[model samples]
Target chain A: MKRNPAALFFVAAVVAAMLFVGFHSARRAGSGNSDSLDVTGKPAPDFTLDSLDGKKIQLSSYKGQAVLLNFWATWCGPCKIEMPWFVDLQKEYGPQGLQIVGVAMDDASKDEIAKFVKEMGVNYTILLGKEAVGQEYGGVNVLPTTFFIDRDGKIVAREFGLQSRSLFVDNIKKSLSQGRAVQAQK
Target chain B: MQLMPRSKSQLAGVLLLFAASALAQSPGKKSPSVTLAPIDPVSVTRGKGAEVSLHFRVAAGFHINSNTPKSEFLIPTALKMDAPTDVALTKTSYPAGKDMTFPFAPDEPLNVYTGDFTISMMVRPLHTVQPGKYAVHGDLKYQACDNAACYPPKHLPVEFEVKVLKNATPAGRNPAQSPHAHR
Candidate 1:
């Protein structure tokens, strides 16, 4: 088959242009969707908000322990599904310096949030999330946005939406392995 | 130079492929949306009540809670309208929700609406209302969710026109009384 040189060159150029467009479009989409993942291996944002018990809870206070900071809302059903897993993980890893923290990002009343937490039998800390706090950690576009922070307060890994329990366990183990643990206060 | 028919056809095919590729990558990045269908102009006689139906479409791959969600935590879809003083919004009827379970919670069934749904409301005009076209503006508040995740509550603006006829509709008209019955 005799292929015209001009036609062949034109087709190749067109293909190259299309590939460039696709690549750049994908990169932009990736950055927007992976805002939380971009913070991996970086210091987790520290925030202080009132817990269900009315006491101010500071993120940096748990610096000595590995932290699993989760941003969730009352309306998020997926968040509800992961609650039991988080509860079980807390019990399994608490003695090993793993501290899980939940931040409620809904506009519900404090009492209502407290009630939900109690009903879930969540053993870890539950804090009322504020817009300012959420903005510090990529604006939390998805519910159940979880970040695994090492004992040194740096985020080792993060997950969006609902993921397998095994993934959570893996991140927890990785978080616990890194960073030095500080002595507990008397 | 004018392109041959074969070259032109080839170019068109290439453009179509590009469009398809662009659309394929947008769903993940684009936010979910619920759009209101354009409503036809409605005519109602003064002093008479009229039923208005509003049609809404949820984006594909997403569902919104029904007017009555099973859980208190879920934000149910609701319509709030500010009818003109002369015209009152009497009643709102919501469609029954579909009981479907999502992968996130297989055991618990949620009351949700997907695809196209209609919300009907009653608009009653007072007897004193003058004949004119009135714009009824409102908003439909809903929280959307997909199989994997849920989005926060959003309010989509709702608007429709109601033309009130100048002639008043007679109320409580009894069928003509028979004169023979009186005898």
Candidate 2:
């Protein structure tokens, strides 16, 4: 039997094509898992807003620490429900390089937010959220949307709507562990 | 080139694969913000008016903007109905909204409806219409919002049937039974 070089070349080309298509499809699937507002493993959008105490706070300033960026409002019932958990988490993890940043999307004045914070006994940094900033963060359509960012400012998880305290703690733990791993590598 | 035809076919195959994958990756349909309960059928006589109440319950932790929102950009809750030529929709009255004050702007108050609320619709059947069963189809347009953020506006469909009876006059009937008595 004569060896057909052309047939061998055709088989090799078909195999190469199939492998290329499989790799491309896998990459597309991986990227598609990320939400437009909360793209995991991507750099988080940075914004500067004034705190309830009249101090300017920049999201990027906490680059080396894990950040729990929560968008909430004073009137949101679920937000009220989750705020106490956030307060406890802040107290428990603040010393461990966890920075919780609360962005108030309220139509009320800053004084009202400050009063609410005082009433809730929130110890973390609370910043005023602007419509533009909300749009930048993928149009925070629900109250209490939270983003967990690692030490490198990359979003590790994006939670929409009200979540359980344990879910939040788990994501925070993951982000914090990733931060430590990166630090160890450095 | 000798390979031109083969390369062209290969390119076509790749494009077809890309189109199929793109379609598969499209987002799924979103669920409605408000759910409507099945309205009980109402009975009315020809040449008389009646009131029908449709109940709507918003999703938990969400409120639909009132008929009159504080800002123009905010979408106000509204109802529209489709009726036969013989049926006339007189008016629709939304329930009163609760005044809510948020921390973002304490001075500016927002009007919103939370939980379960009813919208009363006044419908009248023309005298020229014959007695029969008719279905009224309508939809409620509303933008659901929580204290922290607002969602895109959604439309919820509503439907109910009304049985029309032949108008009859009863002598010495009780005032409560008289259709014109209320009017």
lDDT values, one for every candidate: 0.83, 0.75
lDDT of 2 by residue, B54-148 (tens): 99998665577789876544567999899877988777999898888754336777788888989998778888888889999989998665544
CAPRI rating of model 1: acceptable
Candidate 2 at residue A57, lDDT? 89
C-alpha lDDT of residue A175 in model 2: 81
| Candidate whose TM-score is highest | 1
Task: Flag regions of model 1 displaced more than 4 Å.
Answer: A1-37, A180-186, B1-27, B169-183
TM-score (C-alpha, index-matched) for candidate 2? 0.51
i-RMS of candidate 2: 10.1
Off by over 4 Å in 2: A1-35, A180-186, B1-31, B34-117, B121-183
lDDT of 1 by residue, B1-183 (tens): 345667768766886787666545553455678999999878888787788999999988788999999998789999999999889887899999999999898999999999999999888888889889999999999988777676778899999998988776356755465333467
Residue-wise C-alpha lDDT for candidate 2, range A1-186, written one tens digit per residue: 344466557656765665566556545433112133546777888999998878888999998899999988765545766788999999998888899999988777888778888888998899998989888878766666789999889889887666568989999998887765467866
Count of backbone collisions in candidate 1: 0
Tell me the DockQ of each model, to 2 decimals: 0.28, 0.08
The estimated TM-scores of all candidates read 0.82, 0.51
